[model samples]
Target: MTYQRLAYDDAATPEQMHADCRVVTALLRPAPSIRFEDYPREVVKPTLEISEAAARLATALHLHLD
Candidate 1:
């Protein structure tokens, strides 16, 4: 993330100030623009299938069973 210094003129209006504040907020911590359709497909499982399979095999062998 890059930090930018904002400058406002003395004649800045309420609307301009509000816009500048929004810009600053975005620069400091941008809001997520993800759509609903994309979020459901996100990977929720913490471990991959390969890791789970290896873990199961290790458990069956009683070698460092989790």
Candidate 2:
């Protein structure tokens, strides 16, 4: 599959995409700081929409590169 197609394909159901997005969001989140108070402020926060797009792009790149 082409990169664009792989990244934006409609083959994946909404549930699957949401799950993938959640995984990507978790992976992209910053590690907690040693100080509990600073942890929340320092951590990166990614929206679900952004996570979904990112997950799709990453998958596309990986498959294309292989």
Candidate 3:
């Protein structure tokens, strides 16, 4: 999975801050013999609409980055 965060103005609203946010997920069928990186992957946006909620949640929580 990958996240692309866009630069925003300091005064940007929550909606605007997440307007261009995108979450990319690379999916592959499970297989024992195949290497994870070698498998064919389908790239997609799994939660394109969840960014605003995520941002709000993050802002509310006190994350211990320990």
TM-score of every candidate: 0.29, 0.29, 0.19
* lDDT for each candidate structure: 0.78, 0.71, 0.60
lDDT order of candidates, top first: 1, 2, 3
Off by over 4 Å in 2: 1-10, 30-66
Write down the TM-score for model 2.
Answer: 0.29
Candidate 1, residue 31: lDDT: 68
Q: Which stretches of candidate 3 lie over 4 Å from their true place?
A: 1-9, 22-66
Error of 1 at 7 (Å): 14
Q: How many steric clashes between backbone atoms does each model show?
A: 0, 0, 0
Best by TM-score: 2
Q: Write the per-residue lDDT of candidate 3 for residues 1-66, one digit (tens) a residue.
A: 998776974576877656645322234445576666876797886754556667677667954222
Q: Which wins on lDDT, candidate 2 or candidate 3? A: 2
Pairs that clash in candidate 2: none
- Better-scoring candidate (TM-score), 2 or 3: 2
RMSD of each: 11.7, 25.0, 26.3
Candidate number with the higher TM-score (1 or 3)? 1
